[model samples]
Target: MTQHILGGCLCGAVRYRLTERPYNSGLCHCETCRRTGSAPALPWAGIACAAFAITQGAPVAYRSSARVVRSFCGTCGSPLTYFHADKPDKIDVMTCSLDDAEAFPPTEHVWVSEKLAWDVLGDGLPAYATGERET
Candidate 1:
């Protein structure tokens, strides 16, 4: 999407390219997302798994759930991909990790209700206070 943006982990040990646009690009306030992102909200978007590839190193994986596996660079510890056991066909990418991050603006925000008061965040996108909200 946005003329095919590309990105990788901080160490360049992990790399990826995306030809299709990402859907649901916004902040997620769910507890699981917050832990992995180590942020008040995780900015992410869904993309077809087929459109993504690890062009570089073999990153390590951390299981967030029995059905979900999160990928990150073993060397740099940069959060990378979110693969789901149930879905099997798509993955969620961390938007801030993109090499060409300027290509997309968050269209919506999700899980606003779970956010801690100290972590104030804002964007023009639609905001929701719960995990059920779609970005």
Candidate 2:
């Protein structure tokens, strides 16, 4: 059976679907992610752009950085996806937006160097100081 993962914005205005299981599932502690989601960390799952499709309302896009573009639901301000120019074929979807978020737990923590000083990371997932993990 073909796998389909569905998700939508808080107001249900924006909806999306993934045709396959995503990869690079992780928690991002980057300052941009923290501020964008208004949370301590943002959980994300990476997938090929071809595997993702917006099935509902269009999301408002914002150029978060010179090389990055982020989208969200204009009606409810729910962060949706993050795209980087460097990775033209891939995009990161906010895991929390998934209908079954519990099914995709983060595998590691990235950008931990930018994490809040008081934010305690007791999950014990491998923490990386930066986005480039030593492979």
Candidate 3:
């Protein structure tokens, strides 16, 4: 049986559902993610764009960078998803927004170079200084 994942914004103004499981679950320590999420690192689950669908209110989008856009609940200010124009097929959903956040565990840490010294959250997972893991 396929498991369906349901999530929404803080105020429930925006809700979404994932018809399939997500991959590339990780914690990003890049400055962009930290500032956007107002946290040391942001946990995300990468899902195919086709598998994700908005079930409730629409989220406001902000062009964070030249190729990146972030979406948040306009009514409740809850950060929701991140998208890169270059990778239109994939969308990174904020793990915290998931109804059952505990069910997803980060498999790796990315952008460790920008990771704050105080933020240490690695449970034996692979760490990458940059986006792609060094071979």
Candidate 4:
């Protein structure tokens, strides 16, 4: 049996589970992610939309961009999931929100072109100027 990976919002108002192992775990330094998470970068783990489930309370959704929708807990304002219409089959869950965040460490850094000047990438992870793909 596959072990479920559980996570939730800070206040526990929103709970979610990943039915399968996540992939493409990375840190996103895009401006939108920085603004939404109020951090230099946002770490996320990607999984099939069918593999993710919101098992508890509903989260408030915000259309952060024309094709992007971000969800967060209304009670504690913790960012939860990010959905991009371009990749309808996949969704990214905030790694920091996971109950065992340390278990899903990021293997790469994305959107480095938008990374803050002061935010150093000393972790030695592969970094892409834009997305994960090489140009």
Instruction: Note the Cα lDDT for every prediction shown.
Output: 0.80, 0.94, 0.92, 0.95
For each candidate, give its TM-score against the true structure. 0.84, 0.97, 0.94, 0.97
Model 1 lDDT per residue over 36-126, tens place? 8787777777888988877778879999888889998889888888888877988988888898666665777778787777866655567
The per-candidate count of clashes, in order, stands at 2, 0, 0, 0
Candidate 4: residue 39 lDDT (0-100):
97
Q: Order of all candidates by lDDT, from best down to worst? A: 4, 2, 3, 1
Whole-model lDDT, model 1: 0.80
Q: Model 1 segments beyond 4 Å from truth? A: 1-3, 121-124
- Model 3 has a clash total of 0
Q: Which candidate, 1 or 4, has the higher lDDT?
A: 4
Instruction: Indicate the TM-score of model 4.
Output: 0.97
Tens-place lDDT per residue, model 4, 1-135, is 279999999999999999998877999999999999999999999989999999999999999999999999999999999999999999999999999999789999999999999999999999999975796
Residue pairs with backbone atoms closer than 3 Å in model 4 (clashes): none
Candidate 2 lDDT over residue span 69-101, tens digit each: 999999999999999999999999999999999
Looking at model 1, report the run of 10 residues with the lowest lDDT sum.
Answer: 126-135
Instruction: Give the C-alpha lDDT of model 4.
Output: 0.95
Superposed on all Cα atoms, the candidates' RMSDs to the truth, in angstroms, are: 2.5, 0.9, 1.2, 0.9
lDDT measured at residue 33 in model 1 versus the true structure, 0 to 100: 86
Clashing pairs in 3: none
The per-residue C-alpha lDDT of model 2 at residue 52 equals 95
